[model samples]
Target: MPSHVAPTTAEVYRAHLADASTSSDVFAAGLAEEPAAALVNALAGLDDPPTVRLLVTETVAKWLRRDFHLASTAADLLAAETLSLRVADGSFANQMVVTADAVASILSTDEQTAGPATDDPEFVDSMRERCSEAWETAEPFDLRTPPRSRVYETLGDEIDPAVEADYQAMLDAVETTRSNGYRTTDDDRFDEVELVLLAGAKHELQHYDLSRWGEDVGLASKATFSRTKNRLEDQGLLTTEKVPIDIGRPRQRLVLDDRLRDVEAGDLPEAGRDVIDSATE
Candidate 1:
């Protein structure tokens, strides 16, 4: 007799989506917040992961996407329906439901232990029915980090090569902030446009023309950047100086306030959050 080998969690997920190019839907249930986040992040890391309609609990939907259509149900209802089983259905013919242990393994840095899976038609049908019911009441969620390609497309062909490196660095920093779990869509935190301005001002040190900076990042309009800049200035988180130009009117040079001047580049997101919290309190 041959020893049975277990498939890794990633392998399991990949197998479920193997036929996904033809279109697939995934119903993920009973995942704790961290593991749920890990699952989405892992999927996004795949070289050619398919875009699936992802059904999840409201709490887990906070982690948004570059791919995957998302819908979420009330946490309690989701918990009751799925219990400890973590389900991901690719299609009628391909379904997977794993134990709590297997779900936890998705977050493991090492080779993830695979949990037992069943493709029984009746079981898959029942699970799908439950998920469909949940979907009826689920809300569509659209809060997501913009994909890099979209951002560049918005920037277009006019970017000066001299400042191209700086722009790329800012984009990298924004990604880092997001990877560290800061979300631009969170109401209590600085939004995406505000983050770009803060990062540019803090790290680049050169006085960029505010309106042009907005155009360079392709995140928001010049007026939007101006408005956000004024708000942050009002909050004492940012300051600006007038710069004379031979062209039209003098441009405003964005600068971090004295309080944020000494903060490290990586700490900006958390630091920005803290300031916002303090201001609100």
Candidate 2:
């Protein structure tokens, strides 16, 4: 049987199950992915399974979008999830909180770069609760909508400087970009989920990968993801190649082609419902 914490997203599961024996022998074959064994055990012990699963699902998706979606493979994201999984048990949680300056250091930034790691206990605790949920359910989260961190409630009216600055910048950028006739997938004025998928795939450092784009921009059902991806591929916005790290596998990594980038930059929803409609057909 597939492990409880393994990805339940149809795309991932369908990809894994291409071979009939892949499902039953996944663990023995060393193919068990994130929410690994320990994390699942921890979540299985939690009082509320559904809510915890939802939280972790959102966090994992957001973390992937923010940090790991650019990875050549799923390895980096999986590694981060493994470390964050430590919150499954109280002793480990206490140790991490007491010994570490940031109680939820693992929740935010990854190993390489420095960023504002969360210190708020309530936020961290909420992360822990979400982590428990991810381990329990093991599904991909829709990252189109970001979850609130509750930092404002924890620290009175004043927002964290980083957050405050970001809020102002976003507001300013909206006016500037809107006036300049620039619109992005994140702007919410567009309908094609593909635009949001593209935005999520892009990294701050001019990097991108399409490993989880379909799931993160998901709607209605997994079939929609597959169909949309297929149409986008046909439109020459998405291409595929052998995995750079695991070249022997049947898996083909999705690449962002120049066509989509050009379209995204040229006009705001100029492609219109026709782009999405053709995909549905």
Candidate 3:
């Protein structure tokens, strides 16, 4: 028989959340601030589109129910910690504490291996009580909006059908980029919003007015998108043209520059890095 292969830490946690039979109230402890952040980034950056949406949506729903919590020794990390909690539901339904090493496994990009886990009732109860006490003294923090769900809720109500279709198309393009192995959190230069703009510019094969695209994505403010777009242009990766409109000032239509014109939708991340690298040299 083939040697037993362990499910990845991500796979383990995702399964726990998907199992309705598991306990709803979940607690995680022992993850350091850095690894905790990486875990969230990895979940958000998963290659499968449906899995990405499912994990984000499930984790956020649990968090909203007050059924999920993370404890850390670093009080200053709470704000960022809460964001990670929004991304991960729990490792095991019964276990309240996870080792830092296990978290590192979750963040690993290599062949995913299972981390240590347990379902012992007494052990879980003890850990849960300990974590609850710790949480009482922990600094207060509020959960941020779940990144993936916020996209849908933000764009759910477009009055113009054509505009709504375009928004969906751009979002699809972004997913395509993800499938192509571009991770927003992994890339220091371009964030999720920036990737959306670049991928949209390339794959959509049409120009979107900057403000409108930002409003539709709902991930960042229009002003943020404007700033990011300007930065990308400065780096020679993007260009914009003014389009005549029926009202107000001419709209700026986002376009990928010559460097990115030939890049396939899936090859964006690599191509983007090359352009950004060449510009700085």
Tell me each candidate's TM-score.
0.51, 0.24, 0.54
lDDT against the true structure, per candidate, is 0.48, 0.30, 0.44
Off by over 4 Å in 2: 1-192, 200-223, 247-250, 260-281
lDDT of 2 at 98: 12
- Which candidate has the top score in TM-score? 3
Tally clashes: model 2: 3
RMSD each, Å:
9.7, 20.2, 10.0
Off by over 4 Å in 1: 1-12, 19-23, 63-115, 156-167, 170-195, 198-241, 244-249, 254-281
Candidate 2: clashing pairs of residues: 52-133, 53-133, 56-130
Model 3, 69: alpha-carbon shift in Å?
20
lDDT of 2: 0.30
Task: For model 3, name the residue pairs that clash.
Answer: none
**Residue pair clashes in candidate 1:** none
Ordered from best to worst TM-score, the candidate numbers read: 3, 1, 2
Model 1 lDDT on a 0 to 1 scale: 0.48
lDDT of 1 by residue, 20-73 (tens): 342334555545444454455445445665443455554455543321221111
lDDT of 2 by residue, 88-131 (tens): 22112221111111221112122221112345667645655544
